[model samples]
Structures are given as C-alpha cells and as structure tokens.
Target: MKLLAVDDARARILAEIAALPAETVPLARSIGRVLAEDVAAVRDQPPFAASAMDGWAVRSADCPGSLKIVGESAAGHGFEGRVGAGEAVRIFTGAAVPAGCDAIVIQEDATREGETVLVPAIAAGRSVRPAAGDFKAGAVLLTRGTRIDPWRLSLAASAGRAEVSVGGRARVALLSTGEEIVQAPATPGPFQIYDSGSPALAEMVESWGGTAVRARPVRDELDAVIAALRDADAELIVTVGGASVGDHDLVRAAAVVLGLSLRVESVNVRPGKPTFFGVLGDGRRLLGLPGNPASAFVCAEMFLKPILSAYQGAPTAPATMPARLAEALPANGSREHWMRAKLTYADGGVSVRPYRDQDSSLISVFAASDALMRRMPGAQAAEAGTVVEVLPLSRA
Candidate 1:
C-alpha cells in the first residue's frame, strides 16, 4: 500500500462523513452545540425608546429651565401622559421615555424643588437608548453551523428563543485490541500491561463534542476482534492498536472479513505511519490508530479531531497558529514530524520549544506537552528566532 500524505488522508476521511441530523434542544442546554438553523430576533431589543440612566425625561427645548414634574416612569411601568412643554417626567434607568420627550437630563444635572426641577441644557437623544438599539425584529442573530457559547447563548436568549435547533452529537465507539494488555484494577501477568489508550481517547472524544462509547479490551484473536467490531453501535468506530502488520495485529484482517473498503492504508508521518481509515460493510467509518501512546495521541489530533468536527457540522480544519521558535532545531527528515513542545507567552508574542525526547511510547512527554510544533518533510534547520506553525492541545 502506498503511503498517503496527512492532508490527503484527512480529506478522504472527511469526504465519507456528513453532519448529523438536527435536533431541537433547550436554549440553556445548547452551549457547545453547533447551530443547525438561523435564529432570528422575535421582537426588537428594548422594544421601545428607553432611558439609559436614572434621570428626568424632558423635551430638549424645555431643559436648562425650571419645569413642573408631571409623573414618574419606573421599569415595567410607563408614564401614560406625554411630556408637555415646561414639564418633566421622573424616569429611572431602563424606563421607557414618556411620549413627546426627546432627551433625558440626568438627576445629577438637575435640582428638585417641591415638584419643580431646574435642569441643564441637554441635546436631543441624549441618554436615551433608541428602540431596536441592539437588534431589530426578524433580524438573523445566529447563523447555522455556529457553535454556541455563553455569549452566543445570551444573544439567543435575548432574541426570545427558548429552544434552538442544533446538530446532533456524533456517537463514537472506541475499541482497544491487544493480547498482552489488561484493564486497570486487575493484576496483569508478568508479560501483560494495563490498557491506557482507550480511556484517554474516550475523554478526548467527549471533549471534542462527541459521545464516546467504550468497549472492553479485546484479545488479539481474529474472531474476538471481529465480534467486537460487529457489536459496536455507533456511526464511527475508532480502533486503538493492532493496525500494523505484526502477527498479533488482527484488526485489519477482521475488518477485511467484515467487508472493509480501505480509503487510507497508511500515512507518511513520523510516529504515526501505520494509521489507517476505511468504511465497513455496514456503512460505518473506522479509524485505526497506532498502539504507542504518543503516536495515538498525535494522530487523534491530526485526523480524529477533524473527523469529529465534520460530523458535527463545525469547521473541519485544525487551528494552527504561528509562533517563534525558542530553541534551534535540526533539519527534518523525509517524513513530516509533529514534535510535542511547551508554549511560552511573553512580550506580546508566543514562543515554542520542542522537548529533547520524542519517543512514541513516552506518555509523560505527551502529558507535559501543550503544543505540537510542525516540521515539513525535508525542511531546513530552523534558528532560534524562526517563526513556525503550531497546533494547540485543548487540554493544555
């Protein structure tokens, strides 16, 4: 099988997936969910010309003169009568400005004398929040494909939306395969180690807005792996380990027996060259990851994150930012490399420094890393001050 570039593999995987169907959920529960339809304002914000400060509503022409206090307008209650010439209405903050009033004179700028007030000159529309100041009725405030956050939820609430239509969360099944691996809390034999990848991967899937369904670790037998794959109930199946051509790697053979049509056989990237993607006979997608902890982590960021984003109708591109290199780096080899690194923020700029040890099995190294510094294939050596691209790990 020919090795595929990272971008080509990602593109092919995304092409086989589509956004999940839309479902209506309460506005308060829609945070972190992608919008499936546009949300329009039901009524004008404020809905009327209102006062912005605790003051007196008066005609601009009548200000700077003594005037009789006609009535008071508190929030949720308006002064019914209009503000005639030489008269004023006591208005509190957020109160609707009385009819025929063109401006508000703050209480600080006025003196009250037993039903009469003396105010300073004020301009029309001063201290008055015009109707529809924030938004007008029927105006679209939230568009489709937008992920709802606290601020967006506030906006939707202000638009009078009690419920919103959002994309359904994608259900992902996680399967781990290995004969020498045992689940935690159980004593392992001398040659067996506890499984670690699936637990972390499940949390990653949830953090990326997908529902993770974890299956028990399966032994390397072909039938066991096949049965596990067949029993997974999800739109996407993520298999950890058993992707290489070793004798114990039975995931590929079992998938073939289940009618796997390969889309990506392998990737040409350091530490994750054995990563593969395909579609099963039942029309579900499968992503095979390397068993090494660091390799699996890096490939999840490189491919699985984007796949999950596509499934939720969110932007499918990795968000990479530019930063200066804090230390010198040697020229890259024939394959692309994503070096785990730490990030520093100082002097209004970001700097990245790659760790000296980048072994695939070092879970400690990955735990300490907050960013991945990218180096293209055959790239020249970089100086300390050279600018480079980096992808931020959300957990950092």
Candidate 2:
C-alpha cells in the first residue's frame, strides 16, 4: 500500500465530512454549538438613549450653572419627567436619559447641594449611550457557523433572541477492539490491558463539540469486530487498535468484511502511520486508529478534532503557529513527525521543548504534552531557539 502524505490524508478526511443537520435550541443551552443561520438583532440595544454613568442628565448648554434636580432615574426604573432648561435629572448607570437631556455629567464631576447641582461643561454626547449604539435592530450580530461561546450567547440574548438555530452536534461512536482492551472500572486479568483510549477519545470528542459513545471491547476476531461495526449508528465510527494489517489485527479485516471504501490506507507520520479513514456502507464514516494508546490519542488530536470542527459546514483549517525550540533535536527522516512537547508562553508565541522519550505507547508522556512540535518529512536538524511549527494538543 502507498503511504499517504500527512497533508494528503487530512485533505481526504476533510473532503468527506459534510455538515450535519440543524436544530433550534434555547440560548441557555447553545454554548459550543455552531449556528446554522445568522443571528439577527430583533430589537435595538439600549432600546432608548440611556445614561452610561451615575450622574445628572442635562442639556449640554445647561452645564457650569446650578440646575434644579427634578427627578431620579435608576436601572429598571426610568424618570418619566423631562429635563427642561436649567433643570437636571439624577440618573444612574444604564438608566434611560429623560426626555430633553442630551448629556450626562458623571457624579464625580458634579457638586450636589440638596435639590441643585453645579456641573462642569461636557460634550453633547458625553457619558450617554444612544439608542441602537451597540447593535441596530435587524443587524446580523452573529454570522452562520459562528460557535456560540459565552460572549456570543450573551450578545444574542441581549439582542432579544430567546433561542437560536444551531447545527446538530456530531454523534461519534468509539469502538475499542482486541481482547487485551478491557474497559476501566473492571480490573484486567493477567496479560490484559485497560481500554484507555476510547474513554479519553470520548472526552476529547465532547470537548471538540461531538458526543461519543464507547462500545464494549471485542476480541481480536474478524466476526466479533464486524458485529460491533454493524451495530454502530453514529455519523462517525472510530475503531481503536487492531487497525494495522498485522497478523493479529482485526479492525481492517472487519472493515473489509463490511465493504468499507478506503480513502486512506496509511499515513507517513511517526507513531500514527497505521491510521486510516474511509466510508463504510450506509454512508457512515470510519476512522481506524493504531493500537497504542498514546498513538491513538495523537492521531485523534491531529485528525478527529478537525473533522468534528468542520461538521457544521464551517471547515476549520488546520492551524500551525510559529514557536521557538527550547531544546535541540535530531534530523527527521522520510516520515513526518509530531513530537510531544511542552509549551512555555513567551513574547510572541511560545517556546517548545520536546519530551525525551517519543515511544508510541507512552501514555504518560502524551498526557504531559501540551503541544506537538511538527517536523516536515526529511527536515534538517536544528538547535535551541530555532523557529519551528507546533499544533496545540487538547486532552481536556
């Protein structure tokens, strides 16, 4: 089989992930969900010209003289009377500016004496928030595919939107194959290992805005693996371990039995070469990950994240930022490398130091790594302080 370049493999996988369907959800529960349509402002922000400071509202021309304080306005309660010439209304922050008031003198800038106050001159619009200032009615506050974070959701709510139409969450099924893969909470027998990858991948999926359901582990038999694959009903089915074509591997054999159309056979990347992706019968996507726990985690960070991020019609382009190397490294060979590394935030971007041991099965190393120091295929070696590229790894 031809070893696919890392970029080529990523492109192949990205090309196949179409956007999921949309749904309407309340604003309270819309965090991390992508918008299916533009969120338009239903009403004007501030709704009325309001005071932005706790002071007296008066016509700009009435400043520098004593003005009678007629009424007081506080948040949620408006002073209904108007501010006539030589008159001022005491107003709090976010309170509506009474009629005929054009400027607000902050409390610190005014000297109050019982029912009258002397204030300094201020510009016409000083400390006053005009109607439709933040966002006008019918304006698009959030565009399509905007991820509804806390701030965005707050903006939407303030714009009079009680609910929004958001893209459906991507449902992912995680399958951990091989008899050696026993799930946690159950002690493994001698020569058996816990199914650590599926749970970790599930948490990663949730963090990336996808829902993951882990199926029970299967023995290293083609028939058993095929049964599990048949039962998976999610949009994407991910199988951990037993993916390589080794004599003991059963994942690829099961996919073959299910007539999965292969888009990628192997990748030219260290620790993740055995990773593959394809479409099974019935249009569900399949991703075959290597057996090593850390290898599977790295591949998930490199591939699964991008796939899920693009499942809402907005394809997230892979990001690589420049970083200074904190430690020296050796030359890279034919396969591209994603060395587990730690990041020290610096002036511009970050400083990265690769872990000493890069073995595929080191889960502890992978856990401690916050960045992946990327090396292009056959790249030359470099010393400390050399600029390099890195991709952030999110285990949470």
TM-score of each: 0.86, 0.92
lDDT digits (tens) for residues 1-396 of candidate 1: 779988898999999989898889999888777888999999999899999999899999986899999999999999998889999999999999999999999999999999999999999999999999999999999999888888999999999999999887889999999987788999999999888888899988887768899999989899999999999999999999999999999899999999999999999898799999999999999999999878999999999988887888874777899999999999999888999999999999999999999999899999999999899989999999999999988763
lDDT of 2 at 256: 77
Clashing pairs in 1: none
All candidates: CA RMSD in angstroms?
3.0, 2.2
lDDT of 1 at 159: 99
lDDT of each: 0.92, 0.88
Candidate 1, residue 84: lDDT: 90
Misplaced by over 4 Å in model 1 are 54-58, 65-81, 86-93, 104-118, 179-196, 345-348, 364-368
What's the C-alpha lDDT at position 280 in model 1? 96
Reference-based TM-score, model 2: 0.92
